[model samples]
Target: MNKAINAELLDLSNCAKEPIRTPGSIQPHGFLLALSDELTVLQASANLGDWAGCSAAAVVGGPLAGVIGEDGVQRIVAQLGPELGSHPFYAGTVGIRSKRHFDVLAHRWDRVTYLEFEPVDRAEAADFRHLYPLIGDFLLKVNEAGSIQMLAQQACEHVRAVTGYGRVVAYQFDPDGHGHVMAESLEAGYHAYMGQHFPATDIPAQARELYLLQHIRLIQNADYHPAALVPALNPLTQQPNDLSFAALRSVSPVHLQYMRNMETLASMSVSLIVKGKLWGLISCHNRDPKPVGFEKRTACEQLGQILALCIESREDARELQFRLEVRRIMVAMLAGLTQGSNFIDNLSSVFPDLLRFARAAGAAIVVDDRILLHGDTPGKEEIAALVDWLARSEHGDLYHTDNLSRAWPPAAAMVRNASGLLALPISRIHKHYLLWFRPEYVHTIEWAGNPREKEAADKALHGAPLQLSPRTSFASWRETIHGSSVRWHAGELELALEFRTALLGIVLERAEQMAELAGELGRANKELEAFSYSVSHDLRAPLRHIVGFSDLLLESAGSEDAVQRQRFLKNIKESARLAGKLVDDLLSFSQMGRAALRPTEVDMNDLVNSCIHKLAPETRGRDIEWDVAPLPVVWADPTFLHLALSNLLANAVKFTGQREMARIRISADDHAQETVFHVDDNGAGFNMDYVHKLFGVFQRLHRMEDFQGTGIGLANVRRIVERHGGRVWADSVLGESASFSFALPKHEDEDEADDGAQADNPTKQ
Candidate 1:
């Protein structure tokens, strides 16, 4: 029954929203008085009679002088200023009716002045004079400590001695809000809780916020009853006073119950605030009732402030050292990345430095589809999947997680090797990344109690509505953690970001170099083509003169030695004709490279007919069967398209010259993005092994004596198609047939031309 009740009461959603600031009461060790700006009493604690020798009814609607006398009222008024509105001010010791002395603390809020009075012993009051030296000695010891742990241990010992508590501990909170007992000091035989962990629920979010506002809190006796205010409300506001900064503010019953569960009668907590945040606390616990005077508590508060500064200085020093090491590694790795060299190769050479820079167990470099892994890493397929997921889910250039399984469920399978992942995307456009991995760091946690079970057993046995009671158990519990790696510190993350910037610089520099080299190569190629075109054009007239002179010489020769003369003339004419033809092909190939395209809707059927008609003289006497399919209309330069088609058809006819019966076909295939045309012929095809060389200028599989022509036809065809934003390729069987194909991109406005074409039946020619 308790478990069920606790489960309902301890729901975090309800507990976090509990208003714990206005409890309308204070601890019985002190009494409170609420007065207006004019020193008129508006409210008083019900137990004020016990301290001031006055009845609660008498104090109601009375003047401040009636409680502590006119001298005490003057003392409080003299200390009042703008600073008193925010924090409570110490008004020195005041006597009530010349009997007992009490330390008065006062503050003003919302037109009401709240004064709290706590009785002080004469000896405890004198202890204030000795506080300066005690703190000075503690500061000397703290400064002499070598590390944060040593400093914490020294602080625990000093606080225990001054407060006379049975045990004192330095509790530090992790990034996740879980507390760990970093250091401890205790009396002989006292239970030791050093190195124990506590769940975040031990101090909820609201409780932490309160600690930030009030740096110190004391519970003189955990079992003491709270003193309720007379009339239960302030007359000025008609509501409970906000005791956020009250020294005698009543703590939540849940916290009181928690102290009792630990067998602690009295406890004091001093907050360690670093960088404007609550870092942790110096917690003191007593086995018996122990009341610490105001002066000693003030000393402890100052001690906590000094300790916070030391901690901040030490942490900064440590981070600075780590950053320097990362910087050294970065310099070495960057030096290895020589400009114009392969980026992946250079990075691979410095892979060890890369891993050290991130302080990771493994690293992976992803460039396009290739992945290079070094040190310890997950399987390639798993890494690929993770990269794909990151690409889809993360838009930032950097992503990191200490618990990969929690962020991506699929990572659970590979938790052993990659429980942590730090990703840097070098190129999102190419899906390139640099990843660092950390293996699982499995360990056991010694918790103060079974956090889960205790939270589920926090029942308010008194049936208080909207109250989240504390756990009733304090047994030590051990829990084994899984599927998490060592956390990535802020300094390491910052270094990773710096390295990312450096890597991007290298990648950008290499890309720029490649682009510049490509530009240079392009200019050189154009200059070579222009040179070839100029030489070919200049040789035309010289070859024509040789042919003309040889003809005249042969016609004017006498009958004497006519046979010898005729032989010489024939050789001269043949050489000139071959040379002339070679020059013509070279000029055509050069022109194709330099020509710009004039794209229009081109009728493939009409172009094929024109090419065939130009090849009529070569195919007129042959027994050839021509099958031309209805081809799709394409967007291309008509003149270039005509030249390409003419060369392909001419090659088919020329290669099939020896066949008794020849077969030739022209066809096309239309796709969403392009149109492909094919020309196939049953001819004396060459070997497929030499097909790669067939499109080069002057490249041939057969001898010139057998083919009887210059070998620039296919080269010119490729250049023309390429200049029109298309590609050309050929395939052949050794002795059976050959096929040539070219594809052109579809233009945006080609749909109308395609719809009107006759593409349903074959056209016989």
Candidate 2:
């Protein structure tokens, strides 16, 4: 911020003596009267003789009936009421001075009633009837306009046509509240004030706030004498009446003088409000006294609203077009990146495309200490230093600066060709960035006049606090600007953000893919090692047992008893059968990994019951109790679910053979995201410390004499369940009970189906 702008902001009281709050006067186009509840005149305009045939001094403290007759007073009283709401009420065509017709506007504030009488223009009154069609035509023009600038121009033309002012200018406010004439329509021989800039202080804070509340303001004749109220102070509040909403309320004397200085006889301004903020104004000025009737002014206000809507629509359409262009360019860049080796490697190739897309002079890609440059750029050392500065700032991944030297002074000497910079980081690590740069371009701006001179004149007048005054000269004042390129547009920033997100996604996705490839390779190696180990140990041991038993039988074939030989033969057959079982289990486990999942709604209760029935032979010889609970239907492959459950149930039966009393339980626990099924058995459990190896192929916790089985059941269970995107785990203690559980994602449709099953099978537990 410059020191002059800062000083002007601090010295606001210099213009405070302008007395805007209590002007104690009103425009001469109307006569104002402040009255008590009984119609006693508490205040009257100084020009009361023009309307009431008497001076304001004589009219003060008298009944209004004596001046305008009882009928006129009754008309004013009829509209004033507690039920009238807070807005001003109008009594149409009230007779004043016997021959003149005045539009009577009645409003009450602070327990005091105010009546304003504006002389009606017969010509304007007749034209007001046809205003609807005119406004419709004007709105059609506004909607048909191709751009926001065109729409603003149309609005100025429409307002001028309706109000018949000598000049109508559409002034647009910048982000800093400084205004410039964007469009203008005026009569011949008038000064063309198009493209002139006005300071923010021209419209003080208080005035701007009021403009938001009330959309229109009118000054009928700037040279008219201000009529003071009879009592000067409101009877109830003992303060100036809040005439903020008053149509004929007196304007600040300082503003009136300013108007005279500009040689404008009459003026009116209608606020252009867009999206609930003051976007600009449709300001009208006349060289002669111009009286606009209430009807025409009302029509203009409504037209201003239509113009505001059009302005918003045009701006949105422009933004949409810009975004569409950005999207087209981004799609092309993404396609190019896909063809490259990897995300990081492809970033350099896209730098030129990014530069063109952003209309930048140069671009660079920085990954840690490595830098890739395209077109013109700063030296590597300077660029690295600039990056370090950017990292410490709080702008996050996306930041831009038009005046790079101003932000970082050290860059001024080295970065002559690169005055502006826009940066987007590739990831959250902040180690990589995609940067765009622009060369320094000198610019010469033509201002309407010296802004500082006008500011001084404003502070000097009325002993008021420092404020901006309108400059008298419209001469072109040229100023040369340097050390900056054109500022980045909001749309460009949006494109930069999109670029950042796309690059980030590409980088993360590539990382995930590489990690997945590495994991797959590692798992393949582990599987190969496990297969070789199991074949050498388990298969070899079983074969050796068969061969040894056969040799013993052969040795005793002709010598000993036939019973011994038969026992040896039986041992050989069992060993061979165990080997065959191991091969079949291994095949099944391998197939489970490659099989495609066919997921459907499967009833867990039915699956568990079937598993238990399939193991009926094992359960019959033992004293066992089965505790089953209602289980919800889940989305899974029925075949895989059955296999997984069977392995668990069979393991329970085999492990519990030594127990005097065996017990098994099947139940499911529900959670927000998944459902867990627990299968508990009163069986010989393994040590908890070795649980990590429990799911491995051919991993065993018990000897064959005690368990009487191969050790592939749990491995097959894990493989099948995992292929269905579920996880399996086991918990156990030494020589006690073991609990096995698996969790699967909860599907909404399957869960809803379970509700119907639960209702139908109420005794499922």
Best by TM-score: 1
The residue pairs found clashing in candidate 2 are 13-465, 14-464, 14-465, 14-466, 15-464, 15-465, 16-465, 43-230
Candidate 1, poorest ten consecutive residues by summed lDDT:
756-765
- Give the candidate number with the greatest lDDT: 1
**TM-score for model 2?**
0.61
lDDT of each: 0.77, 0.73
Off by over 4 Å in 1: 1-13, 123-127, 458-467, 520-765
Worst 10 residues of 2 by lDDT: 756-765
How many residue-pair clashes does candidate 2 contain? 8
lDDT of 1 by residue, 1-765 (tens): 122233443343346766578878889998989888778888888888889989777988999999999988887778777577646667777888738888888887767788988888651233576678767888889758988989999889888878899999999999989999999999987788899998888898988998899899999998878888787877877887888888888887667767877888899999999878989999999978899888888888888888998887777555445655676687678788764389899988888988898888999998778999998999889999999999999658589999999999999998998999999887645688999999999999999988875435443344344346676666789999999999987767755765665565455446445545667464334434443443444333444554464445444443234345446546544555555455545546655654556667788999999988888888888998999999887777799789889989999998898889999999999888768899999998888888876766666788766776667788777766665556778898867999999877665664533332212111110
Predicted candidate 2 versus true structure: per-residue lDDT over 1-765, tens digit per residue: 111222332333545444555667777777888888788988887887877677888878889987778778777677667665334566555765646778877777667677888886441222456578768888678647777778878878888888899999888888768788889998998878787777676677778877887788899887777777766777667887677667887886556655665668799999998878999999999988899887788888888888887776556545445644665677678778877657767867777677777889888888889888888888788778877877777567588988888988986874567888898876444567788899898887555566565655555652453553444544566668789888888878865665564454455345435545667564444554566676667765775785586557555544425457557656755665666566656656666765656678789988988998899887887798999999998888799789989999899888888899999999999999778999898889889999977877777888877787667788878776666556789999779999999877665675453333222111211
